[model samples]
Target: MSLFNMPLLIQDTAAIEGDMGMLWMLISGILVFFMQAGFFLVESGMTDSKNAVNIAMKNFLDIAVGSLAFWFVGYSLMYGADMGGGFFHWGGFIFSQGAADLFFQTVFAATAATIVSGAIAGRTKYTTYAIFSIVMTAIIYPVAGGWEWNGGWLNNTDGIMPAEFIDFAGSSIVHSVGGWAALVAAWMVGPRIGKYLNGKPIEMHGHNQMYATLGVFILWLGWFGFNGGSQLAWGGDDATAASQVVLVTNLAASAGAIAALLFTWIKNGKPNLGMTLNGALAGLVSITAGCGNMSEGGAVLAGLVGGILVVLSIGFIEKTLKIDDAVGAISVHGVAGAWGTLVIGLWGVDGDAGIGIFNGGGAAQLGAQAIGVLSYAAWAIVTSFIFLFILKKICGLRVTEAEEIAGLDISEHGTIAYPGKRQREME
Candidate 1:
């Protein structure tokens, strides 16, 4: 099956048959479900313990709130019906999908909204963040999602020259959506206290690398579903495509980790495991948009470039932009997602581009990808900032400085994640 012409799930009836297939999908969903833990672990592990519980709680709550929001309005708006003018008409305020496909997408909707939690961690009030999460899953994400994924104007399906912008998974649709939101939130929240002293960056190390590492592994495991399940079945076109997608994803991740490790070691004169793991994630995010269209070699190249992009983007955002992302979510997801989306034009199989830099050199496809990038950034930034601004005016958006220094576990939730250590400090 050609990349652009892969069979839809509805076309292949037998491909979805048997209890085994259903089991695979359900299990895949479960795995993807557990990625939330991975996000919490990885993010909290990268930041100080003072904010560990805060980060974890945001991840947990965003999923809870975002899921409900997506079910109510996001799914319908994103996929219900394509408006004539490239907008998605809101279907309704209830959970009613024409098929199981809608439910599957809801899980992805939750994933996208949850990605912002880590970016705005350490400062955002729980209530404010909760409202933002709800708005994101229910409106912002779904509206943009309809643009490309659900046959919106961005699809270019009806243009004079038929052009279809493809996102194999969700480089822009989910990751970039969350990434841009993170950018806006981080900007509004400002840097964490003491994060920038005298206009210089301060190192705020994570409390636990173990938690972060475990989170990376869980995300890696979950990505199998993240990409594979997009094929929408376990047999025939879906099965074959899923298998290839997994292969490419794994190759990209491995290459990314290696590239990041080497680059970090070269620049810092040490093997930065944290950054190396992040590189792996960067590669995954980069490949997500074009995973179905690229060959093995293309996948590796994408991963390698993605690894470098994350390192640079993170450093730039933190040091230059003065944004305290807490978990590097903006770089790993936002920058890398843009890379992945553009890679489709560069390395797509049908394109004149060869397997490497020599083969796929065209500007038209690049322009199309750029359109997707700008669209996502504009929508996410504008809507996120407006929503957060409204939230700040309505109910306050940050906890007290005293509450922050004392730790969110105690101040926000009135409990300690590590009671023993907290007691020791108190005494």
Candidate 2:
């Protein structure tokens, strides 16, 4: 039928519908873009005072380098026509599949690339970090993303989870991927000087709590987009799903923050700001995988569980494993990502609940989630080790002891972030 002959109600409604959907997607994308700043402050605040500026630079540079790399190759490797028999594929170069999808994927690509910066914060050379950023965006992250988000093996119909596996956003694909890489990088780089003493733990303090808190708030704000944008529609079915996703995401984060705060208060006899802050993040990470499909109540349960788990896991890693993760990135991202992915098989409530204990399903989905988590962890650890080892051989991943002790702010960048003269190295 001709447009002039079409019914007025149908035509008017369709126009409004299209406009609203576009608006929603655009706004969500913008919010996700802002998260880069949030991550910046959080990482910067977690480091020693001597290296704040250097940390900030690494965060910024990762985005810059990551964006370029993703634009050139990563997007295609991830979302282009799948190859490598659905295992892994190398797609063509820059601007593949046009500009729109590349821009959207670039933000996510950079986030994954940025995660390692926190773990290696105190000792990495700027040049080394920059190079690794490119590798992460162009190779490591894209290949992993292909397996899940882009219809590779993890998300394939013949795959492990198949009918039951789900990740609405990227709890496992993004956060866990980043965390796994961070874990390996930290171990390879070794602990910061004086972080440990003959197997004893030493306290390390942040330079600016104020900046870190601000960063947390920013991250919280950005999460709406992070989860919502995954719907990929501005309105109608997509928008409806996006709204539900945002609601669940917020609930989980809130519950996580509360649970973490209470846990710390009882254990330490006082409210711990850092732990509280991380709790909120823990909730967000835990919900990322299932935000689109979970009920409000399910989100709360996931958030609380994730927050508490993050606290315990961080302690275990630091005390038992003795991994020197400066900002608790590994625990908050890796552990929580795994939990969130599994939680979906339990509490997911939308049409695509997959399979869940709550929905009369047993351990099938859970087993699949576990496989996905372990596979990502193993792959990330092995590849990260190989990548860093090569970097060490060729250009040295770590700075000299003198440079580390002096602090990267001045030693690496030739400027003290703080105004006052600095104290001597802790030794």
Q: Write the per-residue lDDT of candidate 2 for residues 100-163, one digit (tens) a residue.
A: 4466678888888788888888998888888888888998888888887766777555655545
Where model 1 places Cα greater than 4 Å from the true spot, the runs are 1-24, 157-162, 351-361
Residue range with the least summed lDDT across 10 consecutive positions in model 1: 4-13
lDDT per residue for candidate 1 within 302-401, as digits (tens), equals: 9999998899999999999999998889998888998889887775654333322234444566667778887888999999988988988899888889
- Candidate 2, residue 87: the lDDT equals 63
Residue 280 in model 2: shift from native, Å? 0.5
Residue pairs with colliding backbones in model 2 are 21-234, 21-235
Model 1: per-residue Cα lDDT at residue 255: 84
